[model samples]
Target: MNARDPSLPLQADELSGLADFAASAWDEEIVPALTDYIAIPAKSPMFDADWAKHGYIDRVTRDAAAWVESKKVAGLKLEVIRVEGRTPVIFFEVPATKSGSTDTICLYGHLDKQPEFSGWRSDLGPWTPKYENGLLYGRGGADDGYAVYAAITAILALDKQGIPRPRCVGIIESCEESGSSDLPIYIDMLRERLGNVSLVVCLDSGAGNYDQLWLTTSLRGMVSGVLKVEVLTEGIHSGDASGLVPSSFRILRQVLDRLEDSKTGRLLPDSFHCEVPAARVAQARATAAILQDEVWKRYPWSCGADGAFTLPTTTDPVEGLLNRTWRPTLSVTGVEGFPDLGNAGNVLRPYTAFKLSLRLPPLIDGNEASLKLKTLLEDNAPYNAKVTFVPDGRAGALGATGWNTPELSPWLDQALNEASNAHFGAPLGYIGQGGTIPLMSMLQKGFPKAQMMVCGVLGPKSNAHGPNEFLHVPYGKRLTAAVAQVMAAHP
Candidate 1:
């Protein structure tokens, strides 16, 4: 982790100490500790019904708190806060050394991880941390067991260099993977202790690439639910029903066809679509130019699937980038009401079920979209077959709401460019991510004056929430340095 090559853009003492501290911490403390953390199976409450009973969540929180204590920075008070019937939060507060400074900046992340996904490379497992070829492979390394580690390391780097930092509070929660259900409660409960925040840094976001500093200007929200289609009450022989009855599966397919184009993949309903902001479109073009083929090349494209499964809009990578980040899209994330192929029989199924996940534009309302989806799916049933649309939660199952990112402060822009140019010989780049970070909206409402900065190491093929997920080691170290630079200059 400490390999220093001439290629680094370590042009300043602040950046240098930041990189060095990250390397030292990773080698001496973070890797070993994170490896143990990955082994704990700290799945979010949604995925693991027995999360509290299993105690894995609490175990990881304690481990994280212990690591912060080992840093031993002055005025560092680390607490594992447990509220009733909710996941715990690792709340660490550090007073700024800059005299008379009351500026409080919040750094947000989550230790709670997604469930172990299938299709990991042969040599890797979700619980087994493996380091090779400059990547750390394991769940939570990128999304986001590294946030607390990186946040702490950034502050300590400033400490080592005698640089003044604004008052900083790190809120590493245990419920982000569950759509941050418990985070708002804690944010409200601790509003007084949290004080006022001028700046909020969120590390639970995606970078455009690994070569330079990337900032998340906005995040896309989502609407999700299950659509069920039932034609008959009991299974029947397929041969007897083939010509006489409409297949429930076929009817379900037709319903989906109403929402999205089967060929072009464009969303069908006008209500599900929103006008993309011109500013964001311009940013996408700029980032698309910088990334070029990398926008398409980074996917594993297993077995050369890119050739066969490429999107129709692949001709213009810029459009694809916009499509991913700014445009509304739909995905059938899961399905049920059918037996596994291995256990399949000749009987016709009585019903078909599909779990839908729809990604909305950055400015769209998730509740409105959910209502549209439910109406579109259940309004007119084909052949009078029963159709049902059930939301996984209240109307907006994901509490989905996108944010129009405020303009960047001049100081933050300078810090981003300096860090980027120093480390990678490149300028800073900004892009909107397709993923949702609920805290972004909450913080905007909670502290209307705070400028939010979202950055992370989850570049393409870093594969967060997927099998073989990894944290790019070099990017992580450089990003830690970049964040330190931001903190050092926040005042």
Candidate 2:
């Protein structure tokens, strides 16, 4: 069939055609490619220090680039760009089908997977791909490995139906799981080539549920590091040091108290806190109504002997949403200077070290917060113990800043609602994600006027970083078609 006029609005049949094309592309091509991609442990640079030496990151980047080139997209220019000491990225551009259009649509996603976490179902493994009941189970597939495929599929589907769109460009990176530390350099290098980006479709976020499209309004920033406290030069017998010397573990606990309130998960520093925007608060209230108990019930909590599951900090849905997204919290992700349970002895350990991960509010400055955290933990020491908090990453780059999306333009707003209703038979939903996407903040700074469409297939129980992660294939197909609809409606 000939391509439809660029100025004409897409009809219902056209949207259906896009869906058919996406389903075919996914089942026949995307799924097979992803299954293979999942089998290769292309862990992010953060999790795998020897990523370049291992060649997994490069392999996936090359594989994705090859797949895009094989699509034979008309006027498509593709390149696998590399900066000397960093992970590689896939960059592609397709000319606009719309006449005299200068606006650019940037599609962003990552190819890196998180570390293999424990607690998978007996039959499931991190690198083992399992397709059953319309879900693809494995790591990376949902976290963002399917992004490049879906981005290209959306454009191809639009072309198949002769739908018009602005110029499209894709930037698929391989270090997102590691906080996207290498992305800023590439963005600066490609600034001119990126053109006037007016719309951004970021597929590296999450969905509130699989029912309808969910747009991420904001993301929380993150600061991670190692906090170590030392009381003695070597281990000593507990009987000899019982009351004469201070325990390192006790000192560690005291230092952490300066940062958090043990009773509540709130960060003690006032600088970490920020006023939640009224608009976001109102949206949270509406979302709470839509999700109800789902806001807190989605977690896999352990049950007690009384046959009751563990409770969350709050049962109120609105407060739950606000707490996770807007509030600052601390977590101890890893520990060191300890022995295995089987090898533990009755000796006082010399030191205690904890890998601390602090989630900051969206409006806070990550660099400043990280600096403050280092000082808070390292400066004052109980018993004059040797304490130190070293932030992650290189000398200057410490933490990743969060992003609050720019207000949606009228055309894009209407387009999102229309696409949601047409594709999923529901209206668009807005919510904030607690996870951090470092690229969003960079893009917002670079393209201050751009409208962001941050949506993904990571829905309930489709854990991205945890075990038993899976991608909802049906929702992916609908989302691809919906993306095409939105791009076609872009003015």
Best by lDDT: 2
Write the residue-wise lDDT of candidate 2 on 19-122 in tens digits: 89999999999999999999889999878889999999999999999999999988999999999999998999999988778999999999999999999999
Q: How high is the lDDT of residue 399 in model 2?
A: 93
Candidate 1, residue 61: how far the Cα is off, in Å: 1.5
Quote model 1's TM-score: 0.93
Give the alpha carbon lDDT tens digit for every residue of 433-455 in model 1: 88988788889988998988899
- What pairs collide in candidate 1? 9-422
> Which runs of model 1 end up more than 4 angstroms from their true locations?
1-11, 302-312, 394-398
Number of clashing residue pairs, candidate 2: 0
Error of 2 at 303 (Å): 0.5
| Alpha-carbon deviation at 41 in model 2, angstroms | 1.1
